[model samples]
Target: MGSLLDNSLQIISNTTGKSLFVRLWPLSTAPKGIVYIVHELGGHCLLYDVIAARFLEAGYTVASHDQYGHGLSSGTRLHTSNYQTYVADTLQCLEEVKCQYQDTDNVLLFGHGVGGLLAALLAAQNPGFVKGLILHGPIFKFLEEHASTVNVCWYLSYVLPLAYSPVNGTDPALLITDKDQRMKYARDPFIWHEGPRLSTIHAVTTAMGDLEQVEEPLSCPTLIQCGQDDQLLNKTNLTAWSKRCSKTTKLLFYEGAKHYLHMDTPECTIKVLDEMVKFCDVVRSEAASDTDDAVGSEAASDTDDAVGSEAASDTDDAVGSEAGSDTADD
Candidate 1:
């Protein structure tokens, strides 16, 4: 148990003026590449440590940072006072990791729930930065439309800004089937059960709006996994969204699984990870081949130019040597 607990660590780091907490799990062997795992709304990085450990076991470095206004991150908990700031903060984290891991060219972005939404936006913004994407039950839009009454309440809270209101219509039991897991989640010191800020709801809505208009074709390979019984986004929308992607995208739906498919079906999740690793390997091989072809073309061009120059020089030398020999013989 002591050795098991030693594998995880809670790291507090500063990013964009906020104290952001992250969970880092390094593999025993050198990592193939770094994976940036993003958590759901109101969820901390530690919640996904088990998932990260699986990746670590597969010889990949896993890192997850709590989003602003959530977990150990220093900001308004449950409030979306500045949604764009959250996006920008995520971008900063990516840049920081990219700088830190200069040797590792393969970077995979994994996001679950709302984190999946942000991951998609980030990938859409910078196509070349992410090698592949793993979206687990992404919250593209709310299951039910916000009624006018809720909107009015949200507006009032926005005016008040600090006023707290209970988020309605969320089934706590749906998150996890295990009673111990539910109890642990509720009693966790870093977890926040309070309703999200009015500003956050507005920000999510706005982000959804932007996601709808994202016409830029993503170049990275993507895998989107959703539970068939997901109470969040239904299957129809998930199918539609998957079709919008231009790159190689595979969507898998597990029957009888809920929103938290990772916890529900760990074996399936691991299988998906293996598939991703294989896909990345193929991409790397193709990229290396392309580079080799370009180098070979340049080398052949250089060799042809050198042969022409050598031939011309040989002709001149032959003429000079023959003249000298003839004059000497005369």
Candidate 2:
């Protein structure tokens, strides 16, 4: 993580005046595309730098940020009034990335766990916001051990919605098998360590209902990856959600991997990252195909000069900046 932070690290705030920490990587040359990533619950931008670096090597200018209360971003720590607030915050973050990249299309969304949930919701709610999406081990539900206590949480939420739940918390060993990685995860200062907040849990509960009723049938290219051995949530929910997508959708289940697919064993991580890069290639190919078809349509029309201007505009819209692309201030 430290190694990947070699360039363009920033602490920028959102519209709420809540300081938002973002890790952005602009390619050495003009990029073929751009990607916006959201982190898992309790995850910070630094933890995702490895994945961001992979995007850089793949020739896409990359950007990602910590959500309010989760990382260096300012706000309550891992607590919010409603889950929709997260969705809204993510939408704002996406807008900032688009403005910075001067991109309306050619942007893809990547999320892990809760980040995946928010990304999925954002894409479903707003069509054409992203060209594609890639989700890694998204949490569809809490662990079974945690499930038995939901009713109590739901009832208690009314009394003290912002209170933290008294649970022993997760065992890092369960998150990843490698001892060193487990130790690193345990010691990671940015990870939210203090047991769950009732407000946060309540928001998760409500998000379940919201996701169930979204009905948008995701319009973009989508990819969902889950671990067969994941103790947190089964693939059933993930499968059900994939069915709602209107366009291309692919789901893969890893045999021996755990919840943190990104930080799994070297072999697993290699496979996962390779597959993800390949997925991006498909998106790039599709975008290129669209541009070619647009140019061909214009050429076929009778008006030669008008067609040239239209083709040029289409090319610029897909690749170059329009006018005012925003960048972080100090």
Model 2 per-residue lDDT tens digits across residues 171-286: 67667756677888899989987766787787877787777787765889988887777777657667877887789899998888877887888888878888888998898899
Best by TM-score: 2
Candidate 2, superposed: residue stretches over 4 Å from native: 1-7, 143-145, 166-169, 302-330
lDDT to native, each model:
0.72, 0.77
Q: Residues 227-328, candidate 1, lDDT per residue (tens digit)?
A: 777777656666788888988888887777667665655565566556656665665566567679999999999999999999999999999999999999
Error of 1 at 96 (Å): 2.4
TM-score attained by model 1 = 0.81
lDDT against true structure, model 1: 0.72
